[model samples]
Target: MTTAKTPAAASPDTPQPHPRRWAGLAVLSASLLLVVMDMTVLNVALPQLSADLRPDSVQLLWMVDIYALVVSGLLVTASALADRFGRRLVLLLGFTVFGLASLAVLWANSPAEVIAVRAALGVGGAMIMPSTLSMIRHLFTDPRERATALGIWATMAAFGGALGPIVGGALLEAFSWHAAFLVNVPVMLLAIVAGLFLLPETRNPRPGRWDLPGTVLSIVGMVALVYAIKHFGKDGPTDPQTWVPALVAAVTLSWFARRNLRRPDPMLELRLFRGPAFTAGVVTALAVSIALAATMLLLTQWMQLVQGYGPLETGLRTLPEAVGAAIASPLAPALAHRIGARTVLAGGLALSGLGLLVIWSWPGTLDYWAVAIALGMVGVGLGSLAIASAVIMAGAPPEKSGSAAAIEETSYEIGGALGVAVLGSVAAAFYRTHLTSEELAAEGVTGRAAHVAQESIGGAMDLAHEMGGAGARLAAQAREAFTGSLEWTSVAGGLLMLAAALLVWRLTPKDLDLNEVEH
Candidate 1:
């Protein structure tokens, strides 16, 4: 009988620190930071963008969400493309497109034009993210060194996500919303130049041809699915418009998977899930992301609506979460080693659940310090999530690492969207059930006005401002209702995280060594 080769023995090259490695990391980090920052930077600029362009609500939603949608949709294909072509070449191309698209967005005069440019930016971002990680995999061949590198990469990603709102808010306060998009220009230019000089070309030795059909299928399926989910949450799941796209998405994705199962060189290798660690890691990552995404949305609203914080104040108040994550990033591997990844993940989830419970049980009187501490707990949980993802990718076969990374990212993007949609719907339903039309009318809301207010938490608050005494009463009621809903949501999130922890523990092998896996 033939013996299976081990990861360490299969591939003799183990990553060592080279002088140019840090430089390469710098380039990759900048690229990742830019892509992640773009994801949320426009949020602060949305009001300005709408005021300047006068877009409708749907258009506004598209502008806010389309970048993520497209990036998530195209990530699989982009990763495959990176493997087939050269990662460096792909990275540079993406940077160039992103820079040009940023300029286009800055100059856009109409909502349609802006949306178009944002979609283009998404395409560029998709190319950049997967390729950068794949390059990192090639550069850091040693599992331990790769883990360290991923920690830095993960830190940059988290920092960028945290800084986006603050940076965008500052830009908007000082200049215009256009500055938010335009800011990418210089960063992109610098990254492009640095990447060309410092980054090494990396590609698969036996890369398959670009699977165009699979690409189209994935894009259409993901876009349709996400759109359906968003519409379902905003409207109803039973709504024809919602179900129609969802049905189409399901069919297409199923077909895509079936096709991949038969193909020799599939765009995505479905067989990667044979490894229990990878499977458990993906599930843990997905569930944790869903909880975190939902928590972030609810917390933002709680700060602004309940605590009566301005945008800047809310941003500042949330800084502790980022700080906690930053402090924990470098320490993740150590913690993982000491406690084991399953235990660390379980503990992190437990901590996050406790944080959510704390917020849920907050007294009527606002306590900023308590809130900050809760947010910090969530941040620590997020750090664990990051570590889990790093472990998954590091544990994967090097040849299929790009696909593994793509799946990991896809889970996150999808989980985030699902969380916001599901939790937002729950909150909306509770808010409507708690508020009455009589109270709404007394607040200056009438006819379709009450209907619109019932549609969203923001709309409810806006309508409340119109109704004087009754509005004040209704606003208070709405706040209570929203908070109650959020409390339940937190419980659900906690349970989900707990379930994920158990799943990881059960599914992942106890003595599974990365050195034993096939490279």
Candidate 2:
């Protein structure tokens, strides 16, 4: 049974205490698996989904990103509410919402309807994500044990996300795009049932009054910032639509930060950024995700569109990443315990960056083995993400786990959105630049057909079927253009990660110990 003492009454130095913690972790991790898988499954299913829904380019982008945007905007509010009420209660509610939303996808015939369902799923995701981390903080008191648990937790995220493509691909072979969404229903139902029995209810006994203004500010500011970034990538920074939201985001976020600093009990604590380890961890998570998300986005397209692999084959090919991550993630904490977090963190980033470099320098031809090698390298580097989670959780007082979880998850959501926006834009630009209108015109492709071909490889492939011999040329050119874009994007992602590695190296204390810090 959980003690009824108010968190405010406990000393900051006090450690969390709980029974049946490992079993609780199993339940939490299983729930997380479904949450992450939901994100990845969509990536593999996008092509088939597009074929069914026939969404425009803008609508397609929205389908891909709206979930992350909504989840990012709502994370702070969800975390605060979880702390006020009960983590388990909020989590159970999230599972219900998520499962129902998954079922709703069956009726979603248009892109707009799918977007609405995704937004609802995002709300549920925001509720579940922070609670899992906060509960982990409460369940695992010993710092070393907490680190190990966090590593496994992070592993579940990586494995589930990577596994989504495989699962979706297999399902798509036997079923329609609907199967991807349908798969979530049964897993979520199982999670809900298991969680209710195995999970413990915990909350801050003396929670401060809910900060309504701060909550609104956080949501608006984050949403505006992400919107600006997304549009900036899509339509360039000079577009008035992009600049308007950019300005709002800057002003609102600045005000929100100041307001939080002044509050005795802020909804989302800005003070946490003062910790060197915490700051480094957040940055590492952001940079790594930016690189990883962009790479995965392009690679999935390459596998299906360029390589002509079936969905199942594409998914199976992506398993190298999961294998590499599973190998490294469980060992990261143990490695950090011995060598210091600074070394492990920096090394992981470097390894991942190197993997990107390999892909960036690849020859024009698609090489599955080489790509698998690169994926493995990236996975090894991603193992450090678990350490980042550990640092974020360890830096906060046990009473403030919810706040820490919100910040950590917010970084992930924002980083992923930014990655897809910026790098995805770069790819689009390269594709458009390399794909000349004159080249298509040479083959007697004009007007609407040429315009569609210019937009995306999928567009070119679809139009190719109708264009006879000319269509073959267009398809080949589109594939080559996409390959060039992938190479350039890889270069950008690799360099950014290397820079993050250096920054993390500088920020991490020389002899920082996780156990000491937590205690």
Candidate 3:
């Protein structure tokens, strides 16, 4: 446990590790957990939210997606502000907004109101997300201490994500879906109080003047890119609507990147990617997020709708993954010190991919054991995210920590957004293909019923229950179709993770040691 020694020497001007750094990490990790958990809580709450709000498909999609889309758009700007101001201040303000937005759900009777609340939460999330990383960089000056801190930080992030559905499901059982939103209030309030007293204030001493054009380009480009991905997922790649935004994103983002490169002090530190370890860390965060987002969405629905588990039961079943993540994440750093960072980081990705692949090719009839095994594997591999965070934060110079944090958080947001939209789109496409109108008609389901059945497994199941005697056939077919799509989605995510593992493997240094401090 104490293998890595403290820094051997330091000059008079060198900042010592914060006296309350461990306590400070708790506050930082708690805030980050709240933000990340919001990303996935809705996955479990969606059906209930949909039942109450009765949003049309597009409106329903936004209810689920707007939070991530908004956060992705604003993350860069928020990080820049944190660096310019004080990280503690930005974090405290974020807590207020987050609490207020969650409270706003009390009056959110309609889908539009709920969407508005989610968007506000997104703004708060963007502010809170990167500051945790930057603050951790600011807090622990010693490389070894920072590595251990990052392990705990990654643990909370991954655990919160895996635990969201469980918490949401439990909340849904005892209260309305609104409870899912309301639960954030007390935690945020406590965090604000703790942050005020315990957290240290830190910011860039020489943050240059803000770049308005770069800011505008980032918001526009990032929002457009997220929308295009969502559009592609919802409407397929062939649609001109999808490509229009894609083109706009490419143009604006290219300009934004060029602008960053040209400016002496860019809005984002695009230069961070020049470091191999940093690049690998960002890649790991993004790739893992994409797979995790898609898997959680598919699995939540599969368990609830196909297997007929209630929300709470479904949430409880998700615990295997969460348990695995909880166990693996914190231990990763010590493991990395032993075997090397590249092995833990890339190996984790590979193991996670293999886990997903196992699900894709479950032997004989699929059952709980198969899903459990795969989820545990994915969780253990996900533990490598601690290493990913350690590398990303460690690679940056202390002054540019905010930029490094922003890039890392941005990768997570964008990756999650794409995963839910793209891989989810692929799954939807497969479901519709497998559950065709012809097939519905053969099952004595035709007209609007056939249309509904072909639309989504959720719609099919709901309509089938309404059809009474004729429902059994329709329900069975829809479940099978959805299960098939889940398998396909899992395989796609598995392949993506495997590809990412190789890329990061190539990018990470062979002789790298995480215990060494980066100046």
Candidate 4:
């Protein structure tokens, strides 16, 4: 009887690292830092931009979310293009676009104009995200080296998260909100220059014909699905406005799946999901993102609104999470070797869930130390998923690494968006539930004023400034209500994370060893 060959046996030397792989990693990690920083940097700029541009609520929301939506939607197509043309070429092209788009912010005086610039940035981001991972695959052919490289890459991402608020805050202090966008210019220029020298051009030698129909379906379905999820979370699931896109997404994605299954050369290799390790890795990527994004949102609001810290203080305080993540990133892979990837992955998620539960069960008093410790736990938990990303790329063939990267990036982007929409809705609901808005009426605050106070803690605080003595009562009530919302939301987030941990544990293969997988 004939047997299939193992990957290492078939190509024993394929896992060796390239001569300049470390140099290449420096370039790739810097590029990754740039992309991820841009993702978070804009959050600080939003209030200032809103004031200057005078965007209404809807436009403001779009300005905040559209980049992610567009990035998630286009990842698959961009990855496919990278596989066809050249990963390095697509990467450089993305840098050029990203740099020029950053420069475009100079003229962004209106909401519509800023939205257009953000859309361009999104396109560039989609190209850059997947290419970086696939290039890592090309640079570090050995499984152990690749794992270490991914650890460093994960560290860079954590560093970027830490840097975004601090960097943005300092820039906003010294200059206008435009400084946030303009900051990308010099970084991209450096990346583009270094990348051209250090990065190798790699592509799939036997790439299939670009499936245009599959491309369209993937983009449309993803965009529609995210849109439906966002609207459903915000407007309630019963809203008919969400139904159309949800239905379209289901139909189109279903059709797309059927076509891929029938095709000899599909855009996405669905068969990869059959591997328990890949499935587990993908799920880990998705679930961790949801948990991380939602909990971070909660902490940010609590620090600024409840603890009364300025943006700079809040940003600095958030550094513990990054420190924890940086410390844990390399440790996770080492731990995985001693225990197992399954144990480490599930354990990390469970620890994070426990941390969230701590916040949920906290008494009414705000404890900064407890919050910081909890964030550290979440960071360590999230740090373990660096191995998950390694598993994702390791399972795929060298040529199809781009496709795997695309899927991983898509999971992360969509997971973050889902986290915000779902957890934000839960928090908002609890905020409304806890607030006794009618009490404001007894304080001679009725009609428009009462309604405004009931809308948000911010609204209530603003109304309090005008109402003098009644404002203090209203502000106090709003803070209490908002705190209650945080508690309940943390409970929900913790439970979801626990369930995700269980699911990932169940999905992960018993014999799986990251160090032995692809190499």
Best by lDDT: 3
Q: What is candidate 4's lDDT per residue for 75-110, written digit by digit as tens?
A: 989999999999999999899899999999999889
Which candidate has the top score in TM-score? 3
lDDT of each: 0.75, 0.86, 0.88, 0.80
Q: How much lDDT does candidate 4 score?
A: 0.80
As for candidate 3, its clashing pairs are: none
How do the candidates rank by TM-score, highest first? 3, 2, 4, 1
| Model 4 ranges with Cα > 4 A deviation | 1-16
Taking all chains together, each candidate's TM-score versus the true structure is 0.91, 0.96, 0.97, 0.94
lDDT of 1 at 25: 83
**lDDT: worst 10-residue window of model 1:** 1-10
Model 2, residue 229: C-alpha shift (Å): 1.1
Cα distance off (Å), candidate 2, residue 25: 0.6
Clashes per candidate (backbone, < 3 Å): 3, 0, 0, 1
lDDT of 1 at 440: 68
User: Model 2 over residues 194-257: C-alpha lDDT tens digits?
Assistant: 8888888889877878888888889999999988988988889899979999999999889889
Tens-place lDDT per residue, model 3, 263-357, is: 89888989888899999999999999898788778899999998889999988898888988988998899899899899899899999999998
How does candidate 1 score on lDDT? 0.75
